[model samples]
Target: MDVRFRYSDHLVGLIEDAAVAATRIATAPVSSLAAEALRAKRDAGRLSARLDASPLDDATADAVDAGSWARPAEERWLDEAAGEGWLGEPAGRRLDEALGGRVTGEPAGDAAAAQPADGWATALKLDGMPTQQVAAVEYANLLACYDAESELTDQLFEAPMTVLTTLHGLICRGLVAAEILGRPRRTIQAVHDGAQGRVIFNTPDPRVVPRLLDGLVDWLGATGPAGSAGLPTLVVAGVVHERLLEWQPFEAGNGRLARAAARLVLRARGLDPAAVAVPERTLAADPGGYHNEVAATVHRRGDLGPWLEW
Candidate 1:
């Protein structure tokens, strides 16, 4: 007997209803709503990527290498920024001020005075842990790194690896959180053992990877016009996240990779990539729903609305 389930229509209707409800709420400024949505998308993407255990295809591999290869020069500039106190201690103080003393202990009397002005700089190191926790830490670390730097160019080269690694981590974290597997890293292994829906899309083909990276870079570099122009940013992030999942890229970490890539895009577009203070944590709290949303998109050939709405 062959059995198949159809949940796309049901899920899409539910998402549309929620979006309608949100639209009816107190009129939210377009810029503000776009910013928040971008952040949430990034968070979800990071979580998803960190959990998958897939490997990189040749195209993706080249992109990752190119991005990483480009980093040394940027790193030197970053080091200079740090040395000039542009992105070092002074920047830290500025961040604290901008965060409204959230980073520091005192209130910043004005937004302008709080603007990290130079740039935000931070270094994050995650200790070893079982695969799942590692995934979460990776996502958390990426958020920290992205938030620290004010200029996207500084992270241009490292973007691909950052995206892939973070995605791997998030998937692991999600599996552990859901108790779908006792060990975080072992979720893929367990799935394989059970023959429970093979990841179905794991490869390092040279054909698709480069296109993905280039598309991501182009989106990051594209500019928006004045007054409430964050829609493009959110749309690009949503597209990238969905695309990576559709590509599958790795044997086990595709979901996590997609999420991490989304976070990178958000940060590159000058948006906060952290999930800590936003609605993302609330969304992630429901692992089953989160997985279902992603699955819906993947199965539907990347329809995006259901995943993006959730």
Candidate 2:
């Protein structure tokens, strides 16, 4: 990826509010949407490269051009690519072995024994990594991640709570850890307190997650009508994003869930309804900036200005 501006650069120096920026983007000329499709393909390629997966091919790009996203053929190609991305070649091999030495038809939680490492390089190529299996549920999860994008366009416009439920539900749909699937810890829990514990960078306490989430969602118009904030959809998406990250409602898939949730806000508001912005690639392209800004924003007061600027 080319060098891009940091979160603080404010390189565009747009003085408009997030709302205006969103409108400007949403109303972009139809001619430009073709270009947008191209960029989306480019982004998918970057994301695949970052994840040590194969780049999406020209036909996949043509799929986007033909509006085949979330379609069966598109899903088969893209979802499998995403599955490959989530589990690089090595982890895929480990998972392949654990799936009774194949990639398909494994039982759920079969790879429950595999403990993904802590932090960003969780399952990329490394020597003698412990997690060496793919559970049936994890395979379900891979398929679900691709399938959910199709659902987002319709659901993102529903009630905020509905949207919230959808986000968690999607993340939980094919969870490898059957234990934590669709359930938030009722008792107190900490990311750093378990055998899987590692510095999560930052996450609110389990006790406070509900409270903070309640407050944030209400402000976000989740329980009420959305777009009440009057902010640009982009800004709203950013806020939804940061709040989801800070709250960390789920034991796993929080980052993936948050990214999808943010995209939901955009899709609901017609900012990126085609699901082509590929913000995940943006973050993947600059993991350092993402980590730094996520820490900086949450550590201080709930100021979203810096992240929005980025």
Candidate 3:
């Protein structure tokens, strides 16, 4: 159940170019104020694309659109985080902020009177807003906070699972049943292409899920910046994305979590620490290509050059 992949010289060269671009995107001579604003826009675009990638009914999409009124609150939250120097703090403190309801949103209709103390309980004050809207808004906030964490540390590599579960927990807060929240799947899992109406692949046995994840984290730490021989950040990001998608650890939100984690890798590995990169938008733009690449990797048993190249 160890992590595995193969790539060519062409892939290596392409990833090298990507690594340079990623590094420059964050390090270029942009003012901090402008960078923060640009990051906010990037987050919104990425979050919107991610939601669009999921299978949503028209009603849900419309509801989520109505919920977009919370954008002001989201901006305010990001502003506060940036101003308060919350970016490089430990991931646990960020998780605490999420668990404390600070990252949740109130109903858009009630936004004008929103108080700092309202927190998640105000989500119950959604009035007529669909709960789905709350989920979407919460996701937007959680992802922004996650991406804003720019500091890389050895702790992250040593216990990558902590970050993954924390993210899964944030994502599934109200979307999934409580018992399964943040927990690895205990039963068999299969990935189905609802758009194409076919099974893409079956996951490893649940018993192996934990071991496979351990292998992934170990590989990540070994080949990532924490290790002596680090691969290109973009290459590591691609492997993180595909492997997490292949594992199917959580019953829900696996795709979202994988993308978020991949972006984290980009940030942690010095490619896009500012996290303005919207790679998910590229994947979301062509869902068919993304799925096909993943399916091909699954069938080929960790042959990831095609996915990486794509």
Among these predicted structures, which one has the highest TM-score? 3
Q: lDDT tens digits, residues 214-254, model 2?
A: 55545755433443355556666777777666566655656
Cα-lDDT of candidate 3: 0.58
TM-score of each: 0.39, 0.55, 0.69
Candidate 1 minimal-lDDT segment of 10 residues: 180-189
For model 3 the local lDDT of residue 6 reads 64
lDDT of 2 at 60: 46
Q: Tens digits of per-residue lDDT for model 1 on 46-109?
A: 5343233322233433343234322222112123323323224665444333323322111112
Provide the overall lDDT of each model, using Cα atoms, as 2-decimal numbers: 0.39, 0.48, 0.58
Off by over 4 Å in 1: 1-140, 146-149, 153-206, 219-233, 248-257, 260-279
Checking candidate 3 for backbone clashes, the offending pairs are none
Worst 10 residues of 2 by lDDT: 129-138
Report how far residue 140 has shifted in candidate 1, in Å.
Answer: 6.6
Stretches of model 3 off by over 4 angstroms after superposition: 1-7, 32-135, 141-148, 151-154, 223-229
lDDT over C-alpha atoms for residue 37 of model 3: 42
TM-score of candidate 3 against the unseen true structure: 0.69
Better of 1 and 3 by TM-score: 3
